[model samples]
Target: MESMTETEQRATRDQRARFEALARVVTEPLHRYLLRRAEPDQVDDVLSETLLVLWRRIEDVPGLEASGYVSGPAPDPDAVLPWCYGVARGCLANARRADRRRRSLLERLTWTVAGAARETGDADHTALHAALAQLRALDREVVLLWAYEELTPSRIAEVTGLSANAVSIRLHRAKKKLAAQLERKTGPHPGHETDEGQGTATGNGNGRSSR
Candidate 1:
């Protein structure tokens, strides 16, 4: 094998450094993103796949250019996170498709929110999961990206490939629908009591936990 020239060697080092920095900034949020969307068993594999794509496409990440060469400052999260989320979403979809191809229909049907909820035996969690399941797939995704990921409508648009206006509309409608569903399921005061006797589920009126 031929040895790399000095310039090529330097470029390779810079790329590694850049990727390390990017990974540091993105790995935690990306893990949370996957955990919310993927099966527990699949989250690690999907997160690895997502990070592999980020490594290969570091040049495409926004704010990376500003990080400079060789162990520079980390890229701004705001500038790159939406794009990173988009990458994870695609990777997750790919993993899901692959899993569907490998598993029998019976096996796939066993993987469900209701089944998981029953195992947890948490009434609030069960109600939340049931309510979320009622949403159209895309709308549920929008709400998760908003509430779980704490992304704005514009950022969700970047992640979901929808226009900002479309994301906003979906989020608004979905939140209302979720609120109504939770109220029906858990009563008008659809929340748990805190030590102070305050309702913890008064979560932005979106049927999500305020935490």
Candidate 2:
């Protein structure tokens, strides 16, 4: 291989530094978001895709000052995290769809789970899943973003391309629907308690959380 010129070496170093800084800030938060939405085994793969997108689109990531300070009206974490989450959401969905296909193929091959135990061990999670399944896709997304991801409505607006008011409204309605579904399933006090309207998520149009 040819040796790198000094200029090339400097560029490489700068790129590495920027990537390291971005990863240091985003990796943990992105991983947490994926963990909330993705299957346990899928988290790593989804997170890798999210980070890859971040690196490839580094220039677009806001708040990276040339002086090594992530200074601006929007900090690196605030600007990058939600966008990373949007990317991670797509990664997770792709992973889940692939998993479903694989499972379908395995089922067709008559594979038995004689020793494999289902991971739906928690009753609360089971109810929650059932309730979430009942929601419209958009409503479900709003709910997951709000309750599970714990994103503010404005932040979710950034991720989902909805206005802040739209996000808040969707979140408010989604929570009520989810809570009602859980109550129906678990018969009152379903224990899938959600904190709706708990944030600055005020809007006229109702929305739900993300997942």
Candidate 3:
């Protein structure tokens, strides 16, 4: 291979520094995001794919356009994370699609083998998980993004490719649905109310109060 010129070497260094900064800020949150949506076995693989896409498309990450130099300030996590989450979401979907194909084949070949039941580790959240399962996939995703990721509607719009208004509407409806489901499971307490005015709800696990 030909030796890199001084300029090419500097460019390579800058790109590495930028990606390292981006990865440090996103890796944990991205892991949680994928863990919530993907199978335990697939989270690491899908997260690797997501980080690979982020490396390949580093220039497209928001707030990094001006950071071409290694010494420049790191990109803001708030500004960059939503876009990174979007990439992870896409990668997880691709993994799930491939998994479905493999699972279909396995099911055909092992029709006599009993499937294992899914277990939620926390007994407290069993009702919450069951309620989440009852939602339409898109609605459940909207709720997870709002509750677990703690994304604002606009940020969620960035991640999910829905318009901000649509995100707001979906989040509102999903919260009401979730509150109703949880109420039915454990009866309502006086203070346990959905924040309809602010578009928020509470649940036992992985859920956050919205501002």
Which residue pairs of candidate 3 clash? none
Compared with the true structure, what per-residue lDDT tens digits does model 3 show for residues 1-211? Answer: 5556977887777788889988888999999998888878889999999999999998899877645545667678899999999999899889877665444423321222121111211223456567778999988887666654568899999988999999998877766666566557665455545656755566654566644
Residue 151 shift from truth in candidate 3, angstroms: 42
Question: What lDDT does candidate 2 reach at residue 34?
Answer: 79
Any runs in candidate 1 off by more than 4 Å, and if so which?
1-4, 66-71, 104-211
The alpha-carbon deviation from the true structure for residue 117 of candidate 3, after best TM-score superposition, in angstroms, is 19
Model 2: residues with Cα > 4 Å off, grouped in runs: 1-4, 66-75, 111-211
Sorted by lDDT, highest first, which candidate order results?
1, 3, 2
TM-score of 1: 0.47
lDDT of 1 at 51: 92
Reference-based lDDT, each prediction: 0.72, 0.64, 0.72
**How would you encode candidate 1's per-residue C-alpha lDDT over 1-211 as one tens digit per residue?**
5456976887777777888888888999999999998989889999999999998998898778733445456678998899999999999999888665333221221232122222222222556568779999999899777655668899999999999999999877876676667556644332333424444455377856677
Identify the leading candidate in terms of TM-score: 3
Error of 2 at 39 (Å): 1.5
Clashes in candidate 2: how many? 20
Better of 2 and 3 by lDDT: 3
Tens-digit lDDT string for candidate 2 (146-199): 654568889899889999999888877766665566555544333333446455
